[model samples]
Target: MLFNIINNVRIICAKIVQIAKSGHPGMPLGISDLFSILWFYFYKINFLNINSINKDKLIISNGHGVLIQYVLLYYSNIYNFNDIINFRKFNSKTPGHPEKNEIIDASTGPLGQGVGIGVGIGIKNKINSFIFNKKINIINNKIWIINGDGCMMEGVSYETTSLCGVYKINNIILIYDSNNISIDGLIVTYFNENIRMRFTSLNWNIIGPVSGHSYYNIFKAYKLSLKSYFPTLIIFNTIIGFISPCKSYNEVVHGSIFNKNEFNFIIKNYCIKYIFKKKILIDNKIKYFKYFIFFYKKKYFELIRILNFIIPKINYIYIYTKNRYNCINKSTRFVSSVLLKNIFILPEITGGSADLSASNLTKNDFIGFFKKKKRYRYIKYGIREFGMSVINYGINLTKTGINFCSTFLVFMSYMYSSFRNFCISKIKNIFIFTHDSFLIGEDGPSHQPVEHLKSLRIIPRIIVFRPYNFIEVIICWNIALKLKKNIVCIILSRQNFINNEIKFYNVKNIIKGGYFVLNKKKNDLIIVSCGADLEICFICSKYLNKYFLINIFSIYSSNLLNKQKKNFKNIFINKKILFIESSNDNSILKYKSLYTFILGINKFGKSSNTKELLKYYNITKKNIIKICLYIIKKKF
Candidate 1:
């Protein structure tokens, strides 16, 4: 049966790649036997039971070889055979890469992220099982990943691997497809490191450099993995393109498709003789489906009961307004700490900073670090930004917790790959970034963020907010909590902010992303800004009003404002608008209204005091006043 499954997968994979005239088929050919054992025997999955929490997860970390995953899923009856023919076509669920839905949970193609994501899923289930009192029968499952040399070489893989060992994360089996080949010929040309020694150093149990095509060896190794108490790394060495007649073990076969004659010859000789005539039989699917349906119904009610204990039950108004004990003139991160305190009080919030809790203001007295203590809430991520981001997404996948992680804004670049995956997957998590803009005082250029704001804003599905005052801070917090579909990034500042006039601003109107905090009557110039720059806008608006009537608009989230209807455009369009920001002004440039001039820092900031930095970059209140006057003169 294993041999038949492997041969059928190879045939289907060959046909898909040959017809599409694209995709990497070498991995599918080399790793088919291993996938055959995984999907059929080891992985306890019910294709029809999408809601069952007991379903084991399989992540194809080397996403280029996703055709193998698709083929196995088709054989398992999760997808129709017709969908296999439309592989890589637009709008098809069987895309070149796997997307999270009923089948797979992580959309992976870029190397290393899938491995990190797999580790995240492993951690989530571990935490879940802990909450359920270690009842393996209730929510026990495994996070399995098949990664190639590319994933092993990526730094994020090493980070996740090391963390997995440090935490002693269990039930994760990473199968390394060691073909010793890459796109540029042998992997030895670039990567010759001893993987066994490396994984052993990281405390992972190493299995074998066994033959990938041997069913007995693969099954025996997997049996050993199921009994291990720690994370395991299984190594398999196989020919790059094993079954192809012409390109067998060739590097060109890593990504190239065989011609018609070559494919036809192979199919005639191997597939025609060894293929099953009928669809693969699953004698126990009906029994498993019935059991899962009963399990789902029982678990559904149990989950509802669990939610009663986990859901937040607090007066939001009292928490934000009455008990807001922090100083009125507080740093945005300090305000974030106040909100996080209330948020952490909820049972489902679990996360901490990457060693920046003190600086990022993420430390809370209400929750202890989750260091070998299952009863605690916070997880000390220890400066691993990319790993932290991926793990946050994984925790959300459990549908059990609201995950969050904080770090300095300038360091978000280290997690760009994971951030891109976060945006693409639309995984719900609260990612709080502090030290926004160049206002961190003496931290100098390396700590300052000039273009990070615009870079994050351009991501299609993400919500980027820069709160100007405590009211906006509370509003963004509420918005982030209510969101279950997309990620929300709250960019905070290191400077102090206080708006006694926060009551005068329309509190309900802040969710519209942008609103006039000080618009009284018709005016000549409209001052638009967000974050600490809104304070500058306030000062400039006051001084500019003496010369020319001006209206002040505070944009809490420019992305959300752009999403508003046409009627919303009447507020700021066609008017002489002066955009003020301490960071890059590319976000405001998207609105190409006539008579607009942006004042922002487009270069690296210096090591100076807040006042000097603002003046050096011409971002002070007086500078904004002067720029408004110049724009008004030019418009007139």
Candidate 2:
């Protein structure tokens, strides 16, 4: 039966790819044997009840070859043969690679993220079982992932591998496809590193040189993995392009489609167990493994959903009051620490920093670092930014809790690829970035973020907030919580800030994402600003108001304001708007119309005090006054 499934998958997938004229057939053929073994014997899943959390799941980390899974989906009666025929077509559920589906929890195409996502899913289950195991049987399951040689070389893979080792997350099984061939050529030419020594050193349970083709050896290896106490990495030695007549064990077959002659050879000789007489017909599919459930798990699942959130020591009234300041005039990060203390107290919110907890203001005394076998809440994600982001995406799929991670704003480049996935996948994680711009003195230009604000705002589905005051900070947090569908980023500052007047701003207006502090029936100019830059612009506006009737509009989130701009067009369109920001002005240039000028940083900042950096970058009061004059002179 397993032989029939394997051969049928190959022939069907070959035809599916042939129809598209483009699809990876080599991996589908090469990895078909192990895949068949997993579905028929090892993996415990009911395709009808795929949403159930008690069964084993297969995470295809190397999604370059996802046609194999589509074939399996067809066998289970989840997708008809026609859906398989329409693989990789627009508006079709079967995309080129694994996207978010009923079976696959997370979308994956970029290599190495699925490894981290698998670990992330395992991490949430581990934490939940640790916290609430005695309360109920809280959804225990194992995460199995397959990665090729290409995934092993990716730096994000190493980051996640190290994180998995550190956490000792034991419920994960990693299958390494040691085919030694990538798209370019044999990996031996560039990636000849020893997998055994490398993974063993990282504290993984290693089993290898197992026959990827031989069902007996693969079954024996899986049995050993089930008995292991640590996360396992099984190295399967297999042939790339396993049964293709022309390009077996060759890079050409890795991504290219088979020609007519080569495919004919396969249909005639290799497809012995199965015959392609008509369209690939799916069986009743009881052959795919199923675990018996005596009753529905909805009751036990709800037991783990604990909600014990409490208001902070600082009164909730004061947070929403007319004077929402600590009165100490502390830094925005300091202000953030107060909010994080309350947010961390919530049972479901897990967070940590990428080795910058002290600086990122993520240090929590309530729930300390999660050590091996410890019931602590904080996850010490030590310096791995990309790994942290991808793991958060995995955690999001669990649907039990929301998680967050933090780092300096400048380090966003490190995790950008994973961040893009976070937005694309619509993963909910509170991404906190401190030291928002060049304000962090002595960190040098390398640590200062000039275009980072613009970079984050431009991503399609992300909501970026750079709040300027305490009320706006609270408002951004509230707005983020309500906008659960979008991933939210809170950009913080290193400078001290206080606004007694800002606290009196209407909560209703602030909730709209951004609003004007001073607006009248008539005004000469509009000064748009946000974050630390807003404070300077506000002060400068007060002085400029004597000559020009300036209206100050503070934007908490550029994207959020963009949505509500139909009512606020008078503030920008057909008017001379002077945009002031400490970072690059490109983020605000989207509001450009009529006659507009941006008195903002366009170059990298240097190592210096905030005052000198301000002067050098022309972000000073003198510069603001000069720009305002120039804006008034410019014609519409």
TM-score of each: 0.93, 0.92
Encode model 2's per-residue lDDT on 1-636: one tens digit a residue. 567767888888888888999988888889899887776667776665565555676788888788888888777677887898998999787888754666666547898888999988888778866765543353557888989988898888899888888788888999988899998988888999999999998889999878899998888888898877788999999888778768888999888888788889888756366532222322223322111122424433443343222222444455445334462466767777776676676666777789998888888777778774546767888889999888888877776666778999999998888777777666777899999978787789999998888888888889998877666677777666555558899999877865544535676677766788886556778888887777777788779878878888888787887777575634576777788777774656666467777776778878998788878888888878887888787765
Q: Which candidate number would show the highest TM-score if scored against the true structure?
A: 1
Query: How high is the lDDT of residue 234 in model 1?
Result: 95
The regions of model 2 sitting more than 4 angstroms off are 274-328, 372-374, 501-503, 633-636
Worst 10 residues of 2 by lDDT: 284-293
Cα deviation of 222, candidate 1, in Å: 0.1
Q: Which residue pairs show backbone clashes in model 2?
A: none
The Cα error of candidate 2 at residue 625, in Å, is 1.2
